[model samples]
Target: MRAIIQQFGPALESIALEHYTPASLSSSQIQLKMRFSTMNPSDLITISGAYRSRISLPFIPGFEGVGIVHQCNEQDSAFSIGDRVLPIGSAGAWQSYRNIDERWCFTVPNQLSDEQAATSYINPMTAWLMLSERLQIQQNMTVLINAANSAIGLMLVRMLNHLGIKPIAIVRRDNTLQEFEGCKLQRIININNRDDYHSLIKMKHHIKVDAILDCIGGGESLMLSSLLKEHGQFINYGLLSAQPIPPQFWLERPDINFSYFHLRQWIHSAEKIDIQNKLNEVMQLVYKGIADTKISARFSLKDIHSALNYIQTNEETKKGKILLTF
Candidate 1:
């Protein structure tokens, strides 16, 4: 199998594509013929040695993939030889094949294509958990999302619209406003220009916000918390800016609530049955087009270096996920 290996992390150009044998497929495991893989922001961090998890040298690097089961152990599983599945893992996803535990592999809805299913697990699942589970959003309530041009951001916007709620999209560039032009949105604000008081005016003009979903953490997180209604909730799911939320920001506001979310940790903590059930709910939404997993760009497994570079330089235009297809 051809896999992207991090011999010793530096720039993405340093990642080497090489052949390797997969682990043994036990009675409880299945071999997946991977078709597509998604490039996440965390993938960059993992390769650069800045992420919280430390990976040893000469390791395959990819976390989520969509593929077909070529070989399956007949160990009372829900999967079959020809079933299309999404394999969620911490690494070894950027390859031609992956051997995953049957319990960790999930069957995607028939409506999604191979590419859509490939990018499905991470962003859409996070968006669903942020709104449906973590925040417990209700009808007519308002939510705030930073980096609203992203795939997850777009999905959250659509989900809120479906539930008769509102999403206030906070974007950095004026050009991104066009992406959500036709969609039903609460408001659109340029973060650099909008002040807390000014954003409060905009929030009041559109709708009273009940929650915040922040991916761009740093000073922006503090400002986002200000827009939330008194006693409202705030969930930070990513640190695209690679900075932490200050403790004083939440301490100063006694009425507001703040928390952080990580999908991998949540998955690890949950029972296998529970994780699969939650993933099914997220996939169903994607199948119905209530939420979409748009592929903004595609790259080959061999050209991962250029793919990483594109993600860095074209953050705005690359509004959705950058996928690697086999």
Candidate 2:
């Protein structure tokens, strides 16, 4: 088997393709032949030594991937040999083959292509959980999402639109707006807009949102909070800005409440049936073309270094995702 090995912390050059013997499948596990795997900001952060967890060095790096089941144990009969499945929450997906617990693998719907399922889980599930669990939103309610150009952000936009809800997008660059030009968005605002912070607040007051999905922390979190209506929720799911929100801001805004969303936390805490039902709902929407995954680039496992280099250098213009294809 071949895998993207991170012998050192997540430096671009530190990741390399290495050959390893395949492990025997556990009684409750399945051996997967990977076909596609997508990169996330966390992958970059992990390699760069910026991730918070204490990851063991020399471990494989990858979280989401699409593959076919080559071997499975009878402990779970949900899938069969050659069945297309997607690995979620399991790391080391950046490999030719992976042995994953059967519970971590989900049968990919026939409607989704290998490429689409490859990038599933992290982004799509995050988006679904945000809308379904975190916000407790109702149809026709509005929400504001920062970093609207992100893969997860776009998924939220599509899901909200399909539900008859509106999504207001906040982006940093004018070019980012072009990606959602034809999107069924309620509003799109560039943070660099001439509208002062006060004007931005007044604008939000007109069409108040039920919640705010803020990926950009730091001062941006404070700004987004100021726009929230009374009792409206604020979900912080990412920290792309790499800056922490000042304590004073939260103290100053006593009326605004804050909640953090970690996809794993939500999934593990929820009922199994509920999780599967939500995932199925999102998958159905995707099958109907109400949502889609954009593949920005594809690379082989041997070219892992080159792939990381491209992602690190071109983070902004990297529309969709950079995936590793086996």
* Each prediction's whole-model lDDT (CA): 0.77, 0.76
> For every model shown, what is its TM-score relative to the native structure?
0.89, 0.90
**Residue-level lDDT tens digits of model 1 in 135-243:** 8767677777888877778888887787787677887766566788556886777766647347655564556578888888887787666667788888888887878
Provide the RMSD of all predictions against the true structure, rounded to 1 decimal.
2.6, 2.3
Candidate 1: deviation at residue 96, Å?
0.9
User: Evaluated with TM-score, which candidate comes out highest?
Assistant: 2
Native-to-model Cα distance after best TM-score fit, residue 34 in candidate 1, in Å:
0.8
Taking all chains together, the TM-score of candidate 1 against the true structure is 0.89
**Candidate 2 overall lDDT versus native:** 0.76
Q: What digit string (tens of lDDT, one per residue) describes model 2 on residues 81-116?
A: 899987776468888878888777777788888887
Going through the candidates in order, what is the number of backbone clashes in each?
A: 0, 2
